[model samples]
Target: MKVLVTGGAGYIGSHAVQRLLRDGHDVAVLDNLGRGHREAVEALRASSGKEIPLLEADLQDRAVIAARLRELGTEAIMNFAALAYVGESVTDPLRYYENNTAGVVSLLQAMQDAGVKRFVHSSTCATYGEPEVMPIREDTPQSPINPYGWSKLFVERVLADHAAAEPGFAYAALRYFNVAGSDPDAVIGEDHHPETHLIPVLLNTALGKRESATIFGLDYPTPDGTCIRDYIHVSDLIDAHVAVMNELDPDREDRRQMIFNLGTGKGLSVKQIIDAVKEVTGVDFPVEHGDRRPGDPPSLYADPRKIREQLGWSASITDATTMVRDAWKWFQENPSGYASQA
Candidate 1:
């Protein structure tokens, strides 16, 4: 399979590129190098010993993307290109819709031009939006609270509608929870400007990169009075993407849209994650409690049985400690992240 991974220079996309190459798939990267790091793509080339093509272009450039897709003979696409900050989305909702939602529209146009049918979309649990249910499922009603979630949900609808209308088109939208940790080998990992994810923030505090880590909402109605979220390892998340991509057969008569929730079916509170980071890094970092961020649910996890039964895939690294340890290893190796290489 020849796969074109959009945003392959970013954290999770880069990991997906690595996994695809490891699994014997010819891979090419299409990243704008906006939020993604070029050094990460270079590192992947060095590690894999393959001259992977990095198509430095945005999804909005439909003509260029379509030309490249045709030239490379791309069989499938794994989309990870989007602006993914909740707070930022609140302030600038239009940007989220333009980049996350409208960007996919252009990409789909290119896919149509190239006659590519299989797509693995990087969806999110935010589409579920503060559900009353404990374990969210594929059938869960989607009522997104923020523009970020709405942006992704819009794409899910686009994929579904496109698949329904177009014959031989198939897509799998994996709505996943909190994606944590790094590659086990520490080759390429998470590094976002103004980093927002919890695991990296905790690890940075432990590394003395920051003075302290702030725990938002210590009064949530939970065991630790904090919000709980499912943290899936980056590797495991990529594994599910590969499984779905491999399973997508456009020639099959029954091929259509597939939606699955990716998680460990386990929830970890902020307090538990903090403890795990402390134990993993052996650093007692300063911790501060703050009021809850708006729209934050007390608990959010996934009912991963559907994906498990269908794809025979489950999170291999379910322990918070192990997730923290892999992330800690990456932070230790690249304290400044890929910036130094740049």
Candidate 2:
């Protein structure tokens, strides 16, 4: 299968590309280098022994995207492009709407024009928005509290509508939780500017990149009085994506649209994650308690039974210890992340 992976130079996208290549699929990366690193793609190409074609362009460039879709003869598109920071999205809603929502509209138009029907969308659990229920399911009502969540939900609606209108279109929206860990080989891993993820932030603090890791809200009603979240390994998350790609039927007259929640069906608190990092790296790091960020849910995890029974996909890397261990290995190898390669 020849696939075009948008934002393939980013952390999760690059890991997805690596999985695609390893599965014997031809992959091309389309990234604007806005939040993506070019070195990640190069490292993937080197590690996979494949010349991964890279089209440096934005998703909103309809003409360029359409041309690239036709030029590459892409059979499928795995879209990972978006502005994901919840705080940033709150500060600038227009940017989030334009890039995350409108950008998908442009990509959909390009796909429609080029007759590329299969799309694997990288959705998020943020769409669930402070659910009162535990272990969120696919049927959970999408009442997103933040602009970032709304942006993703908007695109998801677009995909659903497109699939309904076009009989040939097929799509899979994988709503993910906190995706952590790196490739076991330590070749590629999480790298973000002013990283916001809990595990990586704690690991960075462990590495002495920062003074201390802040624990937000120890007053939440949980096992440890802190908010808990589901953390999935990057490799396992990509595996589910590829599984959906292979399962998609672009020629189906019914126009199949699949939505799945990808997670380990477990939640770990912030303190637990910090403790795991300390255990993994054997580093006692300073910690500071802080107020809860507004709109933060007490607990967010996935049921995952739907995807497990339907797609026969389940997360294999379930332990927080393993996640922290793999991430710590990568951090030790590339203390400056992709910058070390540059």
Candidate 3:
């Protein structure tokens, strides 16, 4: 399959690029490099020994992207390009809509122009927005509390509508929970500017990159008085994407517009993640408990049975310790992330 991976320079997307190349698929990357690292893509090239093309352009650049898609003969698209900061989305709603929501519309338009039918959208569990249930399902009500969630949910809607109108179009929107860890080889790993994810933040503190890691809202109604979230390894998450991409046959009625929640069907509290980092890295960093952030649910995890039963795909690396170990391996080697390669 000739695949075009959007945001293929970022953490998850870069991992996808590596997996695709290893799976013997012809791959090209499309990233604006605004939030993604060119170094990550370069590392992928070095590791895979493939001169993978990296198209440095925005998703909203419809004409240029369409031309590139046609030139590359792209058969499918795996979109991971978006501004994903929840707090930042709250502060700047328009930017979220413009980039996260409007960007997909433009990409779909390009897909249409290029005659590409298959799409694997990178959705999120934030779209659920504090569901009353313990394990969220694909049919669960989507009531997003933030612009980031709404931005992604809106794209899902667009994909659904587009698929409905075009019978031959196929798409799979994988609503992911907390995606952590890195590639097992440590060739690439999670690196975000102004890092916010719990695992990376805790690992950074353990490495003495920061004074301490703060736990927001430790008075939640969980066993540890902190928010519990399902942490899926980056490699496992990309495996699900590859499975969906391979199964996206528009001729099959059930496979036209697929939606699945990706996770390990288990939840880990923030305190548990902190402990895992300390244990894995052998550093007990200072921990401060702060007031709970608004809109934070007590627990959010996926049922994951749908993907398991249908696609025979379930998370292999489910434990927080193993995730921390893989992540620690990368952090220990590259304390400065991809920038260390320079």
Candidate 4:
């Protein structure tokens, strides 16, 4: 399979590109370098020793994308492009909608034009905002409280609509929870500007990037009085994407739109994650308690049974200790992320 991976220069996208290549598929990366670093993609190409062509173009240009898809003979598109910050979405709803939602529209149009029907979308568990039940399922109510979630939900809705109308169109929306850790080999890792993720933040604190890690809302109803989230390893998340591509048979008569939640089916609280980080790095970094941010649920994890039963996919490296240790290895290798090399 020849696939084009949007946002392939970003953390997760870069990892997915490596996974796809390892699965014996050709991949081309398309990224605008707005929120992604080109160095990650270059590092991947260097590490893998493969000529992964990268198209530095924005998704908004439908005509160019359509032409490029045709030129590259792309059989599928794996979209990981979008503004993903929840708090930033709350502050700038239009930006989220335009980039996350509207960007999908542009990509879908290009796919339709190029006769590329197979798509693997990067959705999020945030779409199931404030769920009443634990271990969220595929049928869980999607009531996003933030624009980031809404943006991804809108893309999912549009993909469903397209699939229903066009029999040739088939898509898999992988709704993922908190993705942590890095490539086990430390080839590529998470590096977001003004990073908001908990694991990386704690690791950075251990590296003395900041004075200490801030514990947000230490009064939640969880066991540790903090929010609990399912942290999926980056490697496992990429494996799920590969599983989706392998399972998607557009030629099948009973082909249907696919939706699955990707996670470890285990929730880890903020305090527990901090403890894991301390254990992995052997450092007790300073911590400061702060009020909880708005729209944050007390706990969020996934059932993950559907994907396991259907695709034979499950988190193989998502344990808390392994996640922290792998992430620590990446941080040690690239203390300042790709910027140090730049």
What's the lDDT of the predicted structure labeled candidate 3? 0.94
Name the candidate, 1 or 4, with the larger lDDT value.
1
Better of 1 and 4 by TM-score: 1
- Candidates in order, TM-scores: namely 0.98, 0.98, 0.98, 0.98
Off by over 4 Å in 2: 253-255
Candidate 1 — worst ten consecutive residues by lDDT sum? 249-258
Candidates' C-alpha lDDT = 0.92, 0.91, 0.94, 0.90
lDDT digits (tens) for residues 1-342 of candidate 2: 999999999998998898888888889999999999999998987888889999999888998999989998999999999889999998999999999999999999999889898999999999999888888999999999889999999999998888888889999999999999999999899999979999989988999999998888989999999989999999899999988888899676533788999999999888888889999899998999899988888899999998899789999999899998988898998999889989
Q: How far in Å is the alpha carbon of 318 misplaced in model 2?
A: 0.8
Q: Model 4: residues >4 Å from true position, as ranges?
A: none
Q: State the lDDT of candidate 1 residue by residue for 1-342, as single tens digits.
A: 999999999989999999999999999999999999999999999999999999999889999999999999999999999889998999999999999999999999999999888999999999988899878988989999999999999999899889878878989999989999899898898899999899999988998989999999988889989989999999999999998898888777554667899999999999999999999999999999888887888999999999899889999988899999998888898999997566
- Pairs that collide, model 2: none
Task: Tell me, by lDDT, which candidate is best.
Answer: 3
Clash totals, every prediction: 0, 0, 1, 0
Cα-based lDDT at residue 237, candidate 2: 96
Ranking by lDDT: 3, 1, 2, 4
Give a tens-digit lDDT track for model 4, residues 1-342: 999999999989999998998888999999999989999988888898999998988888899999999999999999999889888898889988998999899999999999998999999998988999998999999999888989999999899888888889889999999898888898888899989889999999999998998888988888889999999999999889988887787777454578999999989999899999999999988999999987788999999999999878899875689999988998998898889768
Give the CA lDDT, 0 to 100, for residue 85 in model 2: 96
- Runs of candidate 3 exceeding 4 Å displacement: none
